[model samples]
Target: MIPLTLGEVARVTGGQVHPGSPGTEDLRVTGPVVTDSREAGPGALYVARRGEVADGHDFVDAAARRGALAALTNRVVEGLPCVVVPEDPDRLSARPDRPPYDAVTRAFAALGREVVDRCAAAGGLRVVGITGSSGKTSTKDLLAQVLPALGPTLAPEASYNSEVGVPLTVCRLTEDTAYLVAEMGASGAGHIAHLTAIAPPQVAVVLNVGSAHLGEFGSRAAIMEAKSELVQGLVPDGLAVLNGDDEALVETMGGRARDVGARVVLVGLGERADLRATEVVTDERGRATFTLTAPGLGAPEPGLRVALQLVGVHHVGNALAVAAVAHEWGMPWEQIAASLAAATPRSRWRMEVTEREDGVTVVNDAYNANPESMRAALQSLAAMRRAEGRTLAVVGGMLELGADSDAEHAGVGALAARLGVDHLLTVGEVARPAATAYQQGGGARVSSVADRHEARALLEEELRAGDVVLLKSSRDSGLRVLGDELAGVTD
Candidate 1:
């Protein structure tokens, strides 16, 4: 990054400087803000992001002790003068506005953007951002793996798809990067637009719209609109890889993106899909092995049927989207097939199976959630629960879903019941409704818990040797706790 003077940062981001004086001293900065002081470096800028339970400002002293050059905050630090913030979570969260966040934060962002902008300044960054309720992480992982064979690629770690994450990824970009595969996730409006504007991908993939943050966006239509921002914000000569089966997105892109410069590439099993799938099969392990028939290219004879690692039949769609992105980048068909066929999803909670003692299968997919992902995981369990193995669902509440949160939780419960899960254990207050709905929906024995620890405590005692369990929930519920708990005991 080009070292910027404190004055240049103020000029660029219009932030307030403390001590009422400015220095031309330049600080070359890199890296995104992580709370752990150990990650902070000599020139690191620390941002105090506020969450429900923990306020990062509380850690500023710890941050300063770790060699943080500057701390962005509203309060004071003993060693470092705070960059007083205007204190809006969303905006201060973004590019660090002044009167806003501390000058260091803006300066840091400016430095990072300067680096990425410099790389893309000559022509453009061959960026391809993906945003959808269900398949973002999977799709991003797929593209990063497949595109590298064609060119150097960089995608965010896990689901780092947010206001702060997008800019941070942009700042991380070096000229050597040929593909920046970003997953753009949002709660309300403007985020997708903001992030999409930052990446300005040449090819934007809208995987599939699902009941993700319905509470935040208000409705499915709103979610669709928010997700569409990725494709809509595409640069001139950009390609929009759409899901042909997603009626909401297909109609919207077909209706509007044509007016913009975006070139549409439809991907789905539907016959109308530009990149279609055929002869899809799921193995005994619940991993989808599909043959991709992309009419967009030609010769529909044999589709690609690689063994997908992620444990969901629905992820066939995600694989297809990655194939589309690889194809769009001019990667040869055989190479695309090889890259995708060889690709393995980075494991967290998505369909992670652990074999506990006795004969149980632990389907540990305790990551973030929306209605669509919940249904997909449940379906995975339903399909695998057979062989006389009991299907157990350990579910937690989904967050950030505004007013629709309760109904969405209820919907999850209903889905679990309809899937005929052997046992349902709902954790968190929001998931109580789902538990209730599951019982009412003629589901198998339904149980409720106050939190994940309680659920684990019960599972430790109740889980039998021959059951197939599915643990799923939102990030806030800390579903990983269950995964770790199961991982610890299942062995």
Candidate 2:
């Protein structure tokens, strides 16, 4: 964050100054803005949020001890200079925990907005917002790596694509930051709109809208409406990148871009796409090699061949999206392909493949799941060659599918069965529909375990030296630990 005095923060957040001393309002915050007191440091402003089990107010002294500049809270502490705002429940209730939490978030968002606006006014900050039902994180990782080749860039650590995460990414913008790659996500309508207001994008990339959050959003149309908010929020003459392969997205998002008078770039496998890929071939490990052609970037070179080390053919689309952004910035095709070919997955747990000493391969995609990603991961697992070994899917529940949860799980089960998976292990009861579907599809070996321990035991007894296993579930499912332990990523 750019240097802001306690007085400026209070004014921006519509709060009052509750200084520990007489003249501390002039104290400038020049470092990061953090929510947890433990993350506070010199020149940091600690946002004291009230969680379910703990209150952040209790740690004000701890933050002060760590050289924090001030605290943004509703109540005053003895040792810390505070910016006190009124406690309002309705504004702060977007999350699971309940009142002053939302107030703190609202204030924190305002501070972030101020910082972003200041950076934009001073020049050299280009915010690129990426949103999709799936592949947001993967595309973000690609863009993060590609952008830094041009200039200094800041992207979220993992799938930090929520309201709070967006603000945190925005606040990380220093004066020297030239690019901001923000991954925006939404459960319902208007979430991305709010995120865009915090740090508006000059370049907005809308990936495909799939069944990732079908339950929260009742229908595909509604999900499209929510994801379109990114392109709608673009500044005048801003660029809107849409996926040409997804028929729904191509039609809906193309119309949205035209409606807003924003410059549009369609990127995918489509023949008429602005930046298109052709002759896409996936290797034995499910890595892709594709020929990219863009007439917009004038070069006599017919095409650039990009060989990706990342697993899965789905990443071909992600690479094209990143390539479109780089091309818009005038990066040559050879350079874009080079940077992309050299890029690896920076975010953990999504197609993170580790080959154990025993020659077993563990693909940990347990970060999050939906029907689309589940199918993709399963396909990638099946694509890997095993001479005398088999493929196993250690699957679990996919949450927030609403009424379609069972059917989606069943569809994934059918897909696994059709892909010729040797064994199907469902971790929890929520995944029973998938197990049942697998059996219905004439799958030979199918087992349903009550917990991760039971699932691990089953795998230990059944897995062989040359077999390939996939651990895929939502974040709360805790299947990632088993993958980490088995793959030697953790003890």
Candidate 3:
């Protein structure tokens, strides 16, 4: 973070500095801003937030013990220097379903906005905001890897796309930082808009809109409206990169960009795209190799060929988005291609592949799942099946699907059967619909397990040397942790 004195932080956040010692208001914060006490270090300002389970105020002493300079809290801490931001009066009556955006969180968000404004005014900082139903993290990871070749780039640590997460990411900016990749996520209207206000992007990339959060937004059209907020937040000279293959997005987002007077670039595998991919092919390992063409952007030669190290053909769209951003920034096509080709999966549990000593391959894509990504992972799993090996898919229930939950799960099972998967193991009562569908579809051995324990036991008994297995589900289903255990990953 750009160094800020306690007094400066208090003024920016509309708080008052309560000194633990004399002259504390003049002390400078030069380290990372964190919410978790364990991550606190010298010069760190720990944000004391009230969560559903615990209050961050209780951890002020823990943070101070770990070298934190002060705390940003709703109330004063006895021993720790604090920037006291008052709690919102309406917080006590907030709806049970809404996200908790209390006073301290809002104040922390203000501090993040202040830091970003200061950094941009100092020059050379270009903020890029990315939003979509799926692929946000994958694309953010890819851009974080590729953009640094141009200059210093800072992206969120993991899937930090929420209100607090966006601020946490923005506050990390230093004076020399050249790029900020803000991955924006939304469960309802105005979530993206609020995040965009914190770090307004010069470039906004809206990936495809799907059924990832259909329950929350009620419909795909509503989801599109929420995702379009990023483009709507752009300034007149800003750019909007959209997925051309998704006609719905192209129509809606293109209009939004025009309304905001921002320039637009469409990226996809289709011919209508300004930046499109050709000669796309995936190797036996399910990695994609494609030729990227952007005739509209003034290419030097025939076009660049990009080979991705990340698994799955779905990543081809993500790669094109990255290439478009780099090209807009005037990065050499050769450098962009090389950087993309050299990049690997930095984030965990999304199409993360592991090979056992006995030749069995495990595809751990259980980070989070919706119908779109679940289908994509299954397709890659089928593609990566060894010539003589059986393909196995251990799937858990996809949560937050609302009324369509059963049908969605059934569709996944039917897809597995049609893809010629040799075995289907569905875990939990919520996933029983999938097992029923898979059995009815035939041509495969299907089993239903009550939990991950039974599923693991079944796999341990049935998995063979040449078999390839895939684990997929939403984050709350616990399938990601089970995948880690199955793959012998210890942390």
Candidate 4:
């Protein structure tokens, strides 16, 4: 925060100072802006909203006692300095099911936009926005590590890419903050656009267009349109880094990127890409080693060899995208390569590998899932298995896939069979299609369980000492918990 006064907050959020408020116009918020009252501290502003479980307005006094400077709320607290945003009675009547505290959320977004604009105008902050179907979190984690080497950087802790999550991330920016890496995700059009309005970006990275939200958007074309919004919302003179290997992105999004008037840099394994990888190979642990080439630079050398600490060979493209962004910002090729090689998975349950003392290896990639990412994980698992070693895949349902859900699930099973996984353990009723497909496809061994408990029981009985187990599924499937349990990891 850059020290905005209560009066300024009221003005920016279309709010009014309440008569019961404790402070005058000059009382300012100098600490971080937080939605949870428990995060409030000296000079902090607590934003209160009515949620499904509880109303945040009830915590105003607690926040004040905890050293909060004031409350930004839909209604005022008697002893608290508050900025109250008026509710729309028309909206309330039109949509009776809408939460009454939505007015406060709208105001909070506006406040975040104001603060980001203020910081950018002061020449102290640059916002980098990234969007994609599957790799948003992974690539954001990659950039988070590299960007911090340039300056103080802030990014979302996990998959905090929703509307509220975007504003919450923006509110974390400070006066001396140099970089804000925002991971933008969308299930439909206009979601990323709205997030961009809150914290506009100077550099935008669109990783890929995939089937992650096919149910919501209806088709790959629709998903492409949604993901392209990130680049379309870029500031004037901004740069767009795109995945050239994705046909949907290259064909459909190239014109959109041009229309947005942003300089575009294509990144992938394609020979025509501005930033591309070649001579790619994955080692025994499924880590990738590639020759990264950024052509047309004035320097004598245009290629750099990179061996990523990340597990999947698919991450070569991700590293290329990160290198393009860092390159645009003037980071040397050697620095970018070194930073990428030094980076590992910071977010849990996405290719998190653990080798127990008993010689059993566990791979947890259950953060979320889709057809593309499921196939990628299966391929990586196949690469890690030795001729004498057994491989078991504990998979769950991939949700939000709409009408093609069953077919997609079956395809994942077929891929696992093609990759020669020794055992295919499909967890939950929704994922039974995978087991059926694998059995019908002549896959050697398969099992289906109704829940995590049954899956864990069967695995405990079947798993061998030297076997490698891969746990993969959508987040709601609870496969990550089972993976951690099998690995004896507490947190």
Candidate 5:
């Protein structure tokens, strides 16, 4: 992070330098700011948050022993140098259930905003905010690979797209960092807006509005409103890159960009898009190859061909969004295409294809799942099926679908059967509906297991050397652990 003295940090966060740390106000924090004491190092400032499992205040001494410069806390630490943000009595009375450490969280957010503002003023750092129901992480990974060719780029390590995650990501920036890719996710209406306040983007990309959080947002229309907050937060001279094929995004977010005085560039496979894919085709391995055309966005008349190493045909839209952002930054088409083609998946457990010594192929996409992503993964697995081998799917429950959970799960099962999956194994009681639907949909071989162990045992008994298997479910379903074991991935 950009170095800041304790005095400056205290001022920025609306905290007071405790008397125990008197005369230490000039001490500068030069290391990373971390919430976990285990991650604290020399010059690091440890943020003492109160979590449900354990209180961060309990780790103040541990952080001090690990070379931490100071602790940002709600209560003053007796011996440790500290910046204390006291809880407001008014808020406490207004909300009796509010945690006392909420003050510290608010201070931490303020500190993150200050750091980002300082970095942008110092080196002209460009922030790119990406949000979608499903594709945020994948697109962020693609941009992380492509943006570095132009300048020093820092993106969140994985799916760090929450209120705390966004601020933590911003606090990692340095004076020399040129681009920041902030992946924003939302479970409710105001979630994305809260993240955007911390690191407002010069370029915002909205991939799609889908049913990933249908239960929390209540409806697709509400999800669209939440996703549009990123566009609404764009700077006056900012650019909004949206998926034109998603009619809701084009109709709503396009107007939002205009309202904010930001230019909009639509990307997709449709002819209405300003930057679109043409002649798209996916190989047997499900990797896509497409010609990129963007006459509306000022590309050369000759279309650029892009070949992606990613393992899903749906990624053509992701690649197009990356191409749009890179093109807007004046990156040549050849460089962008080469970077995308050479880029491999950086994050784990999403369309991760692994082959065993016995030649069985496992597509481990069990990181998380919703109806849209589940259908996409199943289709990608079907595309990889060999004539000699059977296509099998081991799936678990998709959580947070509200009243539509059963029907959505049934739709996924029906799609898997229609896609010619030879064997279907549905794990957990929540997923039994899918098993029932698959059987009723004329799937010849189907099984319902109580847990991952039963599913694994069934696979071991029935899986053949040439058979291809897909592991897919929500993160909480524990299917990723089974996928890791099957693919021989450790830790």
Candidate 6:
């Protein structure tokens, strides 16, 4: 928010407003600001939204102490106005026949409409909403890094892609931001629609769709429907970029691209895409070399080549997505090339390598795990080529799949078996599921650790020279600590 009057807040959210100061124009927003509260300034109207175990409303008093002028919560605090919705937030089964779940979904849709209307009035922020089955974050990372060359812009700081995260990112959009790259993920249909309402993108991209939330959405078609929500909000004259490589993306998004009044552009290794990459090459170091092509566009389609701060082949697709977007914005091929080459990764966990006292190398990619990212990270390790020793993979259970977790885990485990990782360290309750798959698939030296503590203790004693170890898990699993511990670790 550039700055809104108290009346503006009421007008946007349709909420009752109590005047904070008699003549105040400073609008307040309340949300979590504890270890990270410094990010929010004074006059923030915090939303004490509930979490898994504890109610954020309980911290309302403490949050108020830290400069929240007002708090939005489900339950009424002694001195705050409560914005209550139906009790069930997760009621809306994509199944749709779930009764009041439909009603709840309608309420969220209405809320999303209000959010979109509110953000649209903020003015002049050109938003770029991004969604994918995978690589949304990496593509966002590349977009944020490149856009600065065009003008000052802010992509959401972290996993700011959900309902709560999208709103906060919008709140941070000052008049200074020329572009806002919004990442949208969907567990069900209408999620992308809700996300798009808040940050109605003039330009948007769909990286690709995958079955990330299948446990909730039930099928890949449902997942595609959910992710396609970003394009639904695009202006008719805007551009909708799709991954031509993904068949479902092409099928669902193609006609919807027409429906939104946006022009469809495609990007992929495929020869058909309007913005495509070809002739890509990578060395043992995971440094890529490639020429990009936009065949139908004529005029010898720019011969672009570059190295990236991000290590892994998957990033080529991420870079190509960013390049296509930059091209749409009239950026020169040279600047795009320069930005891609100059972009140093901000990720602390993804493909980070550190050395131990015994000269062992650890590749820390533990910020998150999915089948696609797991395969990419493993391939990066494989290409690293530990000359004297071996590649050790430490994998943990990916969270939030809801069900079918065993099969997905097993798939990654089997891939590890095929990739020839010498030692496998599995963490968490799902360790047995993956380790069994790996061992069954002929992966030797498998060790299913009791926990990170056990894995750390076990790893300290056995790691040898020239070894490349990768640690990965879902964010909830607290795997980054392993990466930090290994950086200067001693046995």
lDDT of 3 by residue, 32-96 (tens): 89999999999999999888899999999999999999899999887788999987778545462
Where does candidate 1 have its weakest 10-residue lDDT segment? 96-105
Q: Which stretches of candidate 1 lie over 4 Å from their true place?
A: 1-11, 14-24, 30-38, 47-64, 69-112, 122-124, 386-388, 402-406, 489-491
Candidate 4 per-residue lDDT over residues 1-491, each given as its tens digit: 77899999999999988763365767889887888889889999999987789989999998998899889988768767899998876644433223232688778879989979887877658888998878888998999999888888888878889777888888877777888999898866667887888888889998888899899889988888778888888988899888888766876777777788888888989877888898999987889998888766432255788899899888888888888888888888789889999998898998999988877789999999999999999999988886566999999999999999999999988888888888999999889899988888888899999999999999888877778889999999999999999989996
Give the C-alpha miss distance for residue 403 in model 3, angstroms: 0.9
Backbone clashes under 3 angstroms, per model:
4, 1, 0, 0, 0, 13
Candidate 4 residue spans exceeding 4 A from truth: 20-22, 89-101, 298-302
Give all TM-scores, in the order shown.
Answer: 0.86, 0.95, 0.96, 0.94, 0.96, 0.87
How far does residue 455 in candidate 1 sit from its true spot (Å)?
Answer: 2.5
User: Which 10-residue span in candidate 5 carries the lowest summed lDDT?
Assistant: 92-101
TM-score for model 2? 0.95
Candidate closer to the true structure by TM-score (higher is better), 1 or 4: 4
lDDT of each: 0.73, 0.86, 0.90, 0.85, 0.88, 0.71
Which structure is stronger by lDDT: 1 or 4? 4
Candidate 6 whole-model C-alpha lDDT, 0 to 1: 0.71
Please give me the total number of clashing residue pairs in predicted model 2: 1
Model 3 misplacement above 4 A: 20-22, 91-100
C-alpha RMSD of each candidate structure in angstroms: 4.1, 2.5, 1.9, 2.7, 2.2, 4.0
Best-to-worst order by TM-score is 3, 5, 2, 4, 6, 1
Clashing pairs in 1: 83-102, 215-401, 215-402, 349-365
Looking at model 2, residue 412 earns an lDDT score of: 86
